[model samples]
Target: MSLVPDILLTGAGAFILVSLVIVFRVVRGPTMQDRVIAVNAIGTNIVVVLALVAAATGNRAALDIAIVYALLNFLMSIAISKFTVERGGVL
Candidate 1:
């Protein structure tokens, strides 16, 4: 077995573990902000996983998708902030 595959597998495993923890927080969080944070974390982890998978499979389209995901994440954050402000900081 090569070290590259081993490293990739380890990285993927770690990303999954962290994603599960974020999932737990998203499910059991007491506050909306906590859940939002978890969701954002999940998105970030998804991007990371996709990038790794793209690298492993030698597919460049995955990189494009990852970039789009990052942009979406940024847009979501901005929209959330705008919504919260419009809602008088209650959201």
Candidate 2:
């Protein structure tokens, strides 16, 4: 029998659904900044999903991976933002 909590499953499912909605923004954003923000949101959602999975499965290793992924996501957003801001000195 599985011991995973329902709340964790629900949270993960919700985040996945939100991420799917964000995909439309990533594909159809009116500006580069908007697309970048959507990508960042998707990355953040993935991190949350990882954390929820770790909590449900009692896998401490997944939590460590989530931390690393979060750091990379933050760095990626900053780098993309800088790139967009400096393209011809404006995006």
Candidate 3:
């Protein structure tokens, strides 16, 4: 049997903590822009977590999935921002 390295696990744990804290901002942001940025931050955090997991497990496929999710996250943020701007940019 094998164990994942401690540092990778620790880094992933830290990012998870940060994502959890950002969830509050997503839930109660005063404006649409704030919420969008928070959501984007969460998305980025998850990708980092996924990459860390992949490294710890020696599975490259998960890293590819993380990259794909990151691209989607970027596109989604742009789309939502555009939609909000078109509607006068407020929640």
What 10-residue stretch in candidate 1 is worst by lDDT? 1-10
Q: How many residue pairs collide in each prediction? A: 0, 0, 0
Cα RMSD, each candidate:
2.1, 1.9, 2.1
Local accuracy of candidate 2 as per-residue lDDT tens digits, 8-91? 979999999999999999999988888988999999999999999899988999999999999999999899888877885353
Query: What digit string (tens of lDDT, one per residue) describes model 1 on residues 1-91?
Result: 4578567757977998999978999899887677777888888888898888787767899889999998998788778867776878654
Candidate 1 vs candidate 3: the TM-score winner is: 3
- Model 1 error, position 63 (Å): 1.0
Location of the lowest summed lDDT over 10 successive residues in candidate 2: 82-91
**TM-score for each of the candidates:** 0.82, 0.89, 0.90
- Model 1 segments beyond 4 Å from truth? none
What is candidate 3's TM-score against the reference? 0.90
* Per-residue alpha-carbon lDDT of candidate 3 for residues 10-91, written as tens digits (9 for 90 to 100): 9999999999999999999999899999999999999999999899988999999999999999999999999998999764
Error in Å for residue 23 of model 2: 0.5
Ranking by TM-score: 3, 2, 1
Per-residue error for 70 in candidate 3, Å, reads 0.3
